[model samples]
Target: MLKSTFLSVACCLFIGHHAFTQCIAGGSNAVAPYASNSSNKGVMFDITATNTVTISCFDANLPALSVGGYEVYFKTGTYVGFETNAASWTLLGSEGSLLSIGLNLATPISVPVNKTILAGQTYAFYITASNPILSTGVLTTTNSGYSAITSNSDLTVYGGAGITYPFGTVTANRAFNGTVHYILGDPLPVEFLDFTAVKVDQSVLLEWETESEHHSDYFEVERSLNGIDWNRLLTVKGAGESSVKEIYQKMDDNPLDGISYYRLNQYDFDGTKTSLKTISFNNKVEIGENDIRIFPNPIIDRFRVFGNQSELETLKVFNSVGEDISGSLTMTCHEGFTDVVFKDQVEGVFILKSKTNSQILIKK
Candidate 1:
């Protein structure tokens, strides 16, 4: 249907349970009347954080950005380097006019980029509009000097503007005007509490629970023999908006042989769809849970037999500070179970991972 999700915040599926901070970057506005041009030249930034982060609200200053909003385009690498690089530009999506900071009007709302940025990656964006903003910076042929606006510890601002919509070539450095905001592992789609797919005879039963939902429309169930190619099984209606836990179920009557993956995707009312999560269910399945789980979530120091133990080779523990302290754990092997003892004085949230399964252990 050609649903344009390129630049809409609807593409953002927030699943983050912790860590949120906002930061602002400085910029220079037009001194004189800017000549009206229908192209986009936007702020550029680089991620320096060690971990991957989700950036939602990044405000780009579009001078004379009028009643009609702007359509934003994005590209990786530097603007000047993309001339013959053959890496085509991407349609980043759009922002509402009410969210834009212009017309010396009412306070503008924050617009979201909703992009998950990896460490050490650089990005640049250009805007296109029907009633283009009137600014001298809109149509600059030469390098207007570099606009280095580094703000938060996560994002460092860089500068580059292009010719017009579908812009490629760049002269030197362009003025970067905007704000950069990011969150450490912030995920917000339909807050999925848990998604599980079970084998029931020849058919597979898919059931999921959501903690909360916002602007949600419907759910699409897809099956993939391999994790790559997917086919839609059916569509289940959504709750639209809800605060309490919402339960949804879909059954796949014709189950595939061996192991097949079931993926759940949620679409907003506007048609922006995001994959919630994927689970692998084997036709020949075990009666118990797919993954061996951990229990007695809140544990103290010393001997804490919180969860069930299975023979695992890959076992690692990470503390709340994102430090790997897997070596500190002392494991006591018994006949049927293993008693996992923690080091004394170690507290806070810890992640215990074995193979594909991870259990969150909170020290109280």
Candidate 2:
């Protein structure tokens, strides 16, 4: 991203536009540095992908601040485009002696490659400027000579020959022709330090660390029983912007039996999402006698286990009337209820067995 010190100005300008108020110069002028009160000028051209355009601007002795930079707004029509199409660049202040302050009437400004543009699209490029003292300077637009001015302040008509003053007067020989360019953004915003998943007793522990993050919003921890159908377990808030290493962890208390897969989905503040590599861990733990108890016999698709189950580990479901069914058991506890979900189990009576207790569960 091409960042500049004029970010605050751009933000304020965009916000003011939202309020339906136009920023005007001292009196009736649309804005200083800009010539026409109508906010349109003569001549426009199209710039293609990754191409470069040179714009001309001059800082003459004016009431505005003498130093600092300005903003550039580009769009396909006479109307300004979205805020994303706007960019700010640096401007050279008056540097020479007093007599030669306005000597450089046409300063060349180049559109950087980082600024993106659509291919095969025509755009009207213009400047929205403010000097160091927040006053508009007498800056002139640099020209590329792609079109001639048909009339002043009438960008809809062009190709005669002459320059038009901002106040809408046509001169015999002057034109404003600035080039527009296009380029793609080429940079990664996040760097991962480490990501790992481990089996912690009856639960799965997922931990990931990022070396640095930019515009990060949050991380979604996704769990999968078969690595095909994934479910979001939790979303951890991220540091909006960070340069230092950040560590995050998520505990999947209700992980599927045998093997459970986990991955991290990072979302940027701009809504861009990226997924980290998936990791699988065996979540099956050996069942042993403990102090937990399952209750409410003849259960439905689910059942609960309670009573001193805080220390209980392994849980499994079995067919009470036939051979051990080919189903996976997943468990999670909350509010004194250990939720047991059976995958691939048919409707019938089943055995819900934990480290400490067993109960007859009915699936209807």
Candidate 3:
């Protein structure tokens, strides 16, 4: 009876060991019949500022899959690198346990992954089997497993002036077999704070101030005939600072025939650039005829004119005491408007006259 009992105990131990090995082998080499060699089995995700995305599993049997240990990679043109393990992937929803056979059969598992991309940059995500034995059946063979996927997630990333990315993609195996995709976004607009044009006798002076700059590389002064097909007049460097005020100036002496439109081209420090608000003025100077009308007669600071002409050859103004006062006034012709500012003249009645025209003014 003692011999029989010992023999029974030994047989039981052998059976238990065999069962354990079978379970491990089955789970590890279970012939992922659905394993796909096609590159399409991968997925890509695009994220921008102020957005979020969720990744989930389709198989109900694959729970507690090893997602934490998987590696992530990114491709930006000729540059390629791996993402830092810090916060690279987040586990969302519920966490399940390992299957009895060492396989993960948790299905419908959800994981939310999010990240903000800078303007002109590209990004994506990837996953690999962490433990061959434990993750055997974690991935599926169906379209849900072998196919690539993407989500509508966006995060906001701030970029300096003129910074942009031309090409980017996400790779699964870091080879041509990985998925390829494109990213989309628009740069923030440029703000022009104070824009003014002063018309002096011989030229039109343009001046403007900026309250803030975004991706500002430089600025180009553009002129247009009918508000279309503009020609570049001048290029000004941009101040690449956010929320900081900047000042700029330009001059256009060669006036147009009709209404002239002027605009600012705000280029970022990078190659990218955008246009600012456009200002228009009419250049009406009669080369042979003069019909000039000066406004703001009680002139305290500046004055303007309404006329039908092409140019102003000369202008003269005298105080009641016959003292020359025109020296203080600076005149410019824009389209059909003339801008004049008095800086040195004193308060008194004055006589104003152009080459072919004359008028009386009272300054108080």
Candidate that scores best on lDDT: 1
lDDT of each: 0.49, 0.40, 0.40
Query: What are the root-mean-square deviations of the candidates from the true structure over C-alphas?
Result: 18.7, 26.2, 34.3
The 10-residue segment with the lowest total lDDT in model 2: 10-19
Q: Pick the candidate with the highest TM-score.
A: 1
RMSD of 2: 26.2
- Judged by whole-model lDDT over C-alpha atoms, candidate 1 comes out at 0.49
Summarize candidate 2's per-residue lDDT along 1-364 as a digit string, tens digits.
1122111110000000000101111111111133321212222222323222121222222222244333333444332222121211111111211121232233323211122223333334434333333333233343334343322221122222221221123322223332222113323346553345544445555666665688888988877777789898899998888887577867777767666667667898888886644555555433233444333223334444543333344455567565544234545545334555543466555655544466555554
Q: For each candidate, how many residue pairs have backbone atoms clashing (under 3 Å)?
A: 18, 11, 46
**What TM-score does each of the candidates earn?**
0.36, 0.29, 0.30
The TM-score that candidate 3 achieves is: 0.30
